[model samples]
Target chain A: MKLTILFGGASFEHEISIVSAITLKEKLAGFDLKFVFCDSDHTFYLIEPAKMKAVTFSKGAYKKMPLLTLAQGSFVQKSMFSKIQHNNIVLNLIHGADGEDGTIAALFDFYSVKYIGPRVDACIFSYDKRYTKYLCEAIGVKYVKYEIIHKNEHCNITIPYPFIVKPASLGSSIGVSVVKDESELDYALDVAFEFDDTLIVEPFLEGVKEYNLAGYYANGTMHYSIVEEPKKEEFLDFEKKYMDFSRSEQVLQADVSEELTLRLKTNFEKVYQGLFEGALIRCDFFVFNNEVLLNEINPIPGSMANYLFEDFTASLEELASSLPHSKRPKVTYDYIHSISQAKGK
Target chain B: MKLTILFGGASFEHEISIVSAITLKEKLAGFDLKFVFCDSDHTFYLIEPAKMKAVTFSKGAYKKMPLLTLAQGSFVQKSMFSKIQHNNIVLNLIHGADGEDGTIAALFDFYSVKYIGPRVDACIFSYDKRYTKYLCEAIGVKYVKYEIIHKNEHCNITIPYPFIVKPASLGSSIGVSVVKDESELDYALDVAFEFDDTLIVEPFLEGVKEYNLAGYYANGTMHYSIVEEPKKEEFLDFEKKYMDFSRSEQVLQADVSEELTLRLKTNFEKVYQGLFEGALIRCDFFVFNNEVLLNEINPIPGSMANYLFEDFTASLEELASSLPHSKRPKVTYDYIHSISQAKGK
Candidate 1:
């Protein structure tokens, strides 16, 4: 099957996206594949009949392609996608559009392509912090109180000093800052503006413990995940999360009361299904003073959070087979079938 | 200041975008304008300043530009945007991306560009249905029972049959459908998916009438506006509300009791400040059984719903000027200046 995996958006999380894409491809090796990727530096690659072999583009000069920027000039018209072989399903493996949000997914809709991910509305909702927070509240899940700092406007920074300032749409803590005082608010806003325009300023949880939950949905059945207490040094940001060696620690599970774990599972599923398509989501939350506060839902998690599911022993193969393969046969009989069905045929 | 008016996205409302861009241009004649547009097709256009001619390449097009096929090597990248004149605000004249949603505004944050719209979180919450309904419920506002259809799942369309389906992320009545029978559910979903993947299905309200309240925020003050009754053939769809001749039956100053109207206005302003930051929003609701069920909020209404102020005989110029234009320039300078100061420039 000629299924294509789109990854590595124009986000700060580009390199990690590469890791995620490669891992996803390896897991899906049983199917014929096409590797679609782009990087932060803007280098892009598409692997036809994707494999471990090295690929080079060298007609005149050697260079790679970037996915976000399609070809310029002549072919940049409406008919561009019309000629491409659409797969049975498109699995979005990238994040941070820095939450480029729903553009790629929307493009899939524009092409009438069948894709496996949250719909554009869900993607849009999942991408923005403010909306995600409300969805959590709607479903009776706990989340922190967040005040929005509008673009080009003063935030009043009055939500008590020691607050967290970060880009609302970004994940992986790309443009996150802990503002301890009035002096730091300006710097926090400046750094955050680098990643996203809108900022969510929420009171810092005094003693926060972070946990991650992963869910997979296949044909209307939801598999609530075991929550993992991330084993990390301090708080990890972009470099710490992706640069591998920089990570002081990483953990797949933590021991907790069965009831609390079940609650986490229930909360994660409620937030996932209550707000978006019951597909796959990596729901993150924080526990402060024994109260769980929703952080956000990642519609498409990095590397599909391959590390998170190890505790359940759900091998990549098992997970891959559980969901329908998006790959398609190189040759299609649709056109011929249509022709034969015609009156004159 | 060298500024761009980024408009015309790959949305069902693309044509109305053209009108919005042209109108913005007609009003922004005094500014140094750079026209950035997403065409009727997939092409992104950079209208040259000299003759207002469409240019083949854009600054950041390099990242966005790629050869149609990987076999066709060394795809030219439209990577010009990295060098756009510094400190320019993008007059995001586009809608559905909602302009106010964090993504485009986050672009402003990335480039330090000033923009006009509701705050990012406000935009996020306002445009989302699940959250909007929750906020309404939180504040004692009435709404209909709704269920979210997770992406591509089967349901007994019978329960919600006689239901209205709408795209979550999209504003305006585009990609909306009413299903009266079980057989129509799939067709309704097929149409709803055209605009967005997330479909919001609610029991269609068949009570009384439809009303829109034009709201604005200036000097941190929320202002109530006259309630407008949309004179249309049906609930707002792109063709019904945005088409060139769709306003032939435009209704203004919808006749209702003063006491009821005053209560709506008071409650609307309260909800607006608490749930949204209004650059401007068109609040739509259904008047059924002597009760008002707040339907949703359009943070970025088509043409900014300028027609709502028709009774005041306010010229487009007067209404447009009332918007935060001058404040934007100062806000732009403040952010840049703050960044410079933080950088020890």
Candidate 2:
């Protein structure tokens, strides 16, 4: 089976997606890899593995590649009398809006393209910060108290001072702000509203221990990765997060009590089961007051969060083989035929 | 501007979508109309307006038409060096899974195609019955009390006998059952689970007054349709709902108290305010104990719910013109370029 890396989208995290794609080319060297780049203009191009470099995309040279169009279950390069089809299972590597935000998932599902990524509903739950809160509430998981504030409405800071504000539907800390007091609220709101129409505000807890766990469910069992406490100062802003995607080395696992680890794994399992089928995902949690609170869900994590798992390649293969297949109902058009015959049309 | 009617999908409601497409061809007769048919295999075809008949599709004649492919912002028929591009704004007329379940919305959005339909987030909220409950809870709207039951889990009828069992993610009455007694519970679960993995069970309210209202937000204001009290004996099953989509004549407005109408409109507004911005949607409500309880949200109503509005064509035109445009973020990739330069790659 061939693996197609689909990366780059019309998103704020487009560059980071490129970095992730290039990194994957090295990590998945053993596999028969095919590279497909979605430009910022949303055009699909078939890029050669040799040309899968950061500068190739940064210099806008990838456009000269063969243009690809999506058809039922395949990507095709159209010719005069026929088309060349690349019937490879796609690895959705695009991040942020078009990748993590149900766009790519929907597109693939509609076209019947087999892909290894978060399904549409999973993306809906994880992509939006507000929806994540609702997801937590539904699953009986704990999350930080946050209030949704839509743009063009009266802005009210009900979450108290020294809080964190983030655009509800964005990733990679693009439009996130740490507001200290009333003086910084307006500027932060302005920055966030530029990225999204709605915002999620939560209390900025100082000295909170944050842990990251990535996993996927396959072969009738849930496979988990070692939980790593992400090292950071205050928070990793957009630039720092962008740089972090380039790291390929495995990080040290977090040293925590077995009970706390079990709690984190349990919460992660609750979020992953049923909702996040067919994809590997990372959940960041904050241990506040001896309770695990979900911070965010990375549906399509950076570099697929390969460093977290001991055998990333083997895990991906298992996930790909055991991806949930949508049951196709028999569409005989029997009802329509009866209706037409009854009407004598 | 040219108007393209995209109908039929890999959904149970595919035939109904064809009926809706043919209905729209007549409804928007004054406009320059084009017909695009998505077969049950998820293949797109360009059908001539003259062949937009029920028999043409039921006989599988649409497969012989010109095959189309989707690209950036347009549908095209590719040749050796040039392609015929149909850069028309699309009217998403497909119903049920692939249509209303965020699939087509994400496809169109990712391709930058201009369309008049519910966006991705709106589809997510309205597509699944369980998610609809969460949406109502977030907005403080009243919905019927229910519990979700997964197919693999123990079949526990916690909602009592004489309840309604529905596939959580399916539209129409495809996999729905009205369980009147304990004996009917297993059969209902079996039927619903065949269509979807999860089921939402709610108390079957007898003699409930159900009202239907269709509307859209356009030109900085909300335009409502005449509230319709559908004439039904018990509930619309699959076959009854199937024939109902073929009705093109205007439905009569319900004769109710002005106070009741105001309450319905207010609740409808609350549901549609921010979530559903561009598309015309219909919300079914049950007036139980003088309170309006949301029954279901039809994101892409059949035949665009033309019978409810006085001037459906004019309303669609206004909505098409005033559709919310996604703000494209500037992708400078300046950060990536700086890092590359520093690393001397």
Candidate 3:
């Protein structure tokens, strides 16, 4: 099947998405790959695969390419009397808002475009931190205790002095702040509220062991990736995360006991089973007091989390083939026909 | 404001949506109205306001109208050199799947189109019955006891003998069955599974007092319609709901004690606050044993539930003006620029 790499959304992570698309162009060289760029303005453009470089986008040269419009089930470039349709299955490579937050997923479903990514409901569950907490509660998965605060609400800091403040709907730590004391609380909340109207605040645990696992379900079975314990200081802030998103080399797997591994994998599967289908996602976990606590879900992980897998390309192909089919209700219009018959129209 | 009525989705309730559009064209007669029809094939067409009748869609004559494409922030009809843009704020009148199931809302939000309907998260919470149950749990609202059964799973009748079986994701009564005994269970499960992969089963209560309340939040306050007590038999089947969707006359207010009315209104507010913003939604509740239990949420109700309101057009205008603006994270490429400067690029 032809694969179209969709990148660059109207998101704060637009540049990061460009980096991911460029990295994929090198990794997935054996596939019939096509590149489509969505500008921050939400317009689509078809770019040459040879031009898949960070400089090509950073220099604003992609705008000179063919302008495309999303039609019924494909992207089309139109002339006076003819239109060229690109009907390849889209690999949603945009990292944040429009891609992982259910905007593009919904648009693609509405137009009947087949794509490899989270569906609308999955995006809804994973995109917002508050919803993720509720999902963990519903599925019996342990998550860090957090309280949500909306903008303009009273600053009731019940969690404690040292806490983590994050924008509820953002990815990549764009507006995350670790408050060390009471003096830093207002600054952290103001920064977070700049990114989102809602903020989720959780108690900051010192020296938490963080493990990242990436995988996808395909061919009637789950494919697991080696978990990596990311080596970072305190937390990954925006600059460190910007550098982290561009990494493509495989890292050393986390060294842990079999029992701990089983526990982590069990919690991961519980989170991924029914909610995440047709998408390769990464879930970060915090292991504290011999319990696995889900941190957050990366619905569209950077570089597709290719570094975590042993054979990413083969697994992607299997996932593409085993994508869930939308259960479209058979619209026979029988009721309308019966109504028309009753009216004698 | 120019209001565009979008009807006819690729859903089982496509006919009901057409009836809703036709009814709105009559009740909202004083407003500047335009009609757009989405055929079951997922193609869009522009129809004349005078042709907003069930016969126009039932006979497939809408296919002959001007073909339209959804461009950025508006719907457009294109010719050789130029395109005519219909920049009206769309009133999402399409019921069921594409309308109430977060498809159209996500598409509209992606393309920056101004619309009056449930946002994506709200649609996610209200469209599926299982998710609605989770939502009730999150918000501390009272809902009926239920069990979810997936297709191909063991047929476990954990609930009592007499219960209502419903397709989890479908709206209206298309794939709903009331099984009075074990013999009727298989047929009900089969019918419900044909419509959706998941089914939500709830115990059937005899002589349950059902009440429907419709409302929308706008201009810093909640505006509620008169609570309606629908007069029906055992349950509203497809044929009964078919006749119900086309009613344009105002429904009579339910006569109940002030205390009971307050309880219903309080539950409705809890469900609608922060979740069903920017859309007029109807909540159906069952008062059993003096406790109000939420049955389901109609995110995009038939005829916008205008029959329940005192001044439907004015409330609609207020909602249109007070629609929630998406919190777009400022995409300043500061991080990228800083990285580039550090590398001396």
What overall lDDT, based on C-alpha atoms, would model 2 receive against the true structure? 0.89
TM-score of each: 0.58, 0.96, 0.97
Listed models, DockQ each: 0.09, 0.72, 0.72
Ranking by DockQ: 3, 2, 1
Q: What is the C-alpha RMSD of each candidate to the true structure, in Å?
A: 11.3, 1.9, 1.5
Taking the tens digit of each residue's C-alpha lDDT, what string does model 2 give over A1-345?
479999998889999999998888888888999999988787899999999988888898998899998877888887777889987899999998889989888888877789999999999999998999888987899999998899999987778789999999998888899999889999999999999999999999888899999999999999998999998688789889998787677777889889988999999999999989999999999999888999999999999999898888898899999989977656778888887778887
Alpha-carbon deviation at B179 in model 2, angstroms: 0.6
Which has the higher TM-score value, candidate number 1 or candidate number 2? 2
- Which model scores highest in TM-score? 3
DockQ of 2: 0.72
Chain B TM-score of all predictions, in order?
Answer: 0.70, 0.97, 0.97
Q: Pull out the clashing pairs in model 2.
A: none
Tens digit of per-residue lDDT, candidate 3, span A1-345 = 479999999888998998888888888989999999998888899999989877677778999999888877899987777899999999999888899889999888887888999999999999998899888888899999998899987878689868999999889998999999988888898899888888999999887899999888998888888989988688777777888788888887899878877888888899898779999999999998877999999999999999898888887888899888876666666787887789887
Taking the tens digit of each residue's C-alpha lDDT, what string does model 1 give over A1-345?
Answer: 445566655655554555566666665556666665543333445544334222122121113332332332211212444534334345667666622366554444433455556655577567878767666667778888888787787657668878888888777787898888888777889999876667999887776888888787655567755578876555576556654312212344677788878878878767765445534678888888888778888887766665566432343334344543322112222322343356254
Q: State the lDDT of candidate 1 residue by residue for B289-316, as single tens digits.
A: 8777787887766655655664322333
**True-structure lDDT of candidate 1:** 0.58
